[model samples]
Target: MQDLRTVLSSDTIIIGDGAIGTMLQSRGLVAGTMPEAWNSERPEDMLAVHRAYLEAGANYLTTNTFGANRIRMREGGLGSDVAGTVERAVALARQVAEGQAWVAGSVGPTGRLMQPLGDLSLAEAEDVYAEQIEALIAAGVDLIVVETHHDVEEAGAAVRMARQLGNLPVFASFAFNPRGRTMMGLKAADAAVAMEALGVSAVGANCGDGPEAVAKALEQMHGATDLPLLARSNAGIPQLGKDAVTLWDIEAAAMAQHAQRFVSLGARIVGGCCGTGPSHVAAIRAALL
Candidate 1:
């Protein structure tokens, strides 16, 4: 597969894989279990998820390491082998990629808040990000993705670590509330501009209310920077189902409709987030066509 940088340089619209957690849930992942643990315990299932997305037309295969950082893993009682888990996750993604797609090392925010609001300091946050990023780089990922972050500072730390570690492309994306701002009240345009200053390859929104909310965020971000934008919205608002299961309101066709608008708004990457599945990814691929 072409390097993500080369792919981005072309006019091709990239399709990122849909929700890993959602797919795992469908495959019998227990609630509150750190999904990253499955990297070692249930490798076959992880590969299956990657294969489904690739078959559905995802150009970027995101690893199942979103919460694989040291602090989060330790807090979740998943042990101290951050690099081990990350390497396994990347290996699973690569096994499925087979050079047909780029393996993106997924680095999500530390669950803790930074100083003045929470105990974790910026310096400490960078250290946490450093460990996971080091593992990602060592494991041969094509790029790093700092995603689903609410705080720009926290996401910046991950971006900074990835940049400090290597020359791979780093894409930073935030989660927005319905009001078009981060949960921290940071505006979409402001977040995009800030990430741009951090030298991210692309900046945009992910895992918000639904496609319309993500579309609004991309519309705001489109005017803020020259960087490529990514839009990975949830299938829709979450609703409670029987047996404590969570369901999304939007259907595949509906999410695909907004995906078309995302491309028109300058989004170079588009896909689904929470509650989305392979069907949703296939719909997005079709919509882009």
Candidate 2:
């Protein structure tokens, strides 16, 4: 497989997969469930998720290993199986893609703040990421993405680990609120500069507010760095119904418009996040192309 950096430089646009954790939750997965465990226990379901994104026109499908690091796995009583889960997650993604799309090993934060704000030291964070990276690399993923990160320190740690482990390209993405600030209070520009400074191939925002808010953040990030940008925002502002949360079809069209603006602002990769599905991805693909 080609390196993601090389591929992106040659391609006009890249289509990233939509939200996985929340999408699974919508399909009867309870909160606090260890999603990675499904990679081994229910491989078909994991494969189906990846296939849906591919069929929807995603050029890259992220592995189901976002929370597969030992620390997070421990919280779900699957600490000892983190390595196995990570391996299976990558393998399943690759199987589903079957040369049709790139498999990006997804590594997320440990759900704990880094030093000075929480008990986790930088060194400890690095070790946790290294464990996940090793499994992804051994499984031969085409690239790695550190996403939904709130803390700059944790994002940097994952980037460093990716660089050390393999020659694969790394993309670091942060999550933000409607105010255009991360949970850690880092601005969009700051996140861009921080990730680029760590030598990541690309940096952008994901899993944050709806299209409008993320588009604003992408504009700020575009001014902050020269690296390729990625934006995967939610379908729209989520609506809480009596029994469930839902987003209307109009939101998907609105997101497509936002995706076009993101491209104009220099985003090379675009897709949907929470409250988004194949329909949202299809809209983005149509608008971007």
Candidate 3:
């Protein structure tokens, strides 16, 4: 409901809500299940998550639509009704937002790879992104965030589609490896430059190994572009659990160290990725001020 671009461009630091999937898990979401299903199947539970983040002082809440596109939703058995899926997700967040905070439509990478590498072509990928983002715009999202995107072309297509299909601003952030390069070999600065060229309102990093790594990635993004930067790191370094799946252990105070560092480095937006919650966001928000 608010203008994210104006708020973020000002002296204020925008704090985003932390991990949606992890929070859903704590509320009875089973492992390997699609989190977006809660939008329709468990709207109340989804609203609870949004309210928690807002109560904890998040200025921006992302809708649970990261995987609400046609191909990914169908793969996770969340149905191929992309429009209905995103509309419901935005509605759920808007219900809790109540005009007090802004809602960002969460768009992640499609699980598929683009052609010359994978089967999908840039044009084909554009169609998928257009469908997903169009739904978010029509549903009245305050902004569109294309996050954790690895492929330069894929991210470009998403940013471009958002610009063409919606009047809302778009921010693109990449998920970088420990070495500060994306899975597709684009560096953080390169990613920022690439996205800025496509008219993204902001560019930065997210879903990295942890805060330390994310700080490094954001530092890399500096000096390449003057656009506002965002950083949504994992709570801590992911550790292998007994199930052999990666888990996070970054505490609220644990994020404080890197949170300050990110602000000092010019990050306009700061929050957590996997293994984060309201506590983590509260810490980051407090540290930012």
> Considering every candidate listed, which one attains the maximal lDDT?
1
> Ten residues in a row with the worst lDDT in model 2?
242-251
lDDT of 2 by residue, 1-289 (tens): 4556677777579999888876776666766787777787778877788888999999999999989998889888776676788888888888888888889999988998887888999999999899899899999798899998998888999999999989888999988887778888999999999888888888988987776667777888988999889999877666666676654334668778888888988899898777788778988999888
Model 3 shows how many backbone clashes? 0
Q: What is candidate 2's CA lDDT for residue 49?
A: 83
Error of 3 at 128 (Å): 0.5
Off by over 4 Å in 1: none
How much is the lDDT of residue 139 in candidate 2?
Answer: 92
Top-down TM-score ranking: 1, 3, 2
Q: Per-residue alpha-carbon lDDT of model 1 for 1-289, expressed as tens digits? A: 7667877888889999899998898899998889998998889999999999999999989999999988889899898999899999999999999889899999998899888899989999999999999999999899999999999889989999999999999999999977789888889999999999989999989997777778889889999898999999998888889999888888889889889999999999998898988899999999996
As a whole number from 0 to 100, the lDDT of residue 50 in candidate 1 is 95
- Report every candidate's CA lDDT: 0.91, 0.85, 0.88
TM-score of every model? 0.98, 0.94, 0.96
Question: Global lDDT for candidate 3?
Answer: 0.88
Residue lDDT tens for model 3, 1-289? 5567777678778888898998998788888999999998899999999999999898889999998888898899877899999999999999899898899999998999888889989998899999999999999899999998999999888899999997888989999887888878888888888888888888888997677668878888888899888989988776788866657887899886778888888788888889999999888888887
Error of 2 at 28 (Å): 1.9
For candidate 3, the 10 contiguous residues with the lowest summed lDDT are 1-10
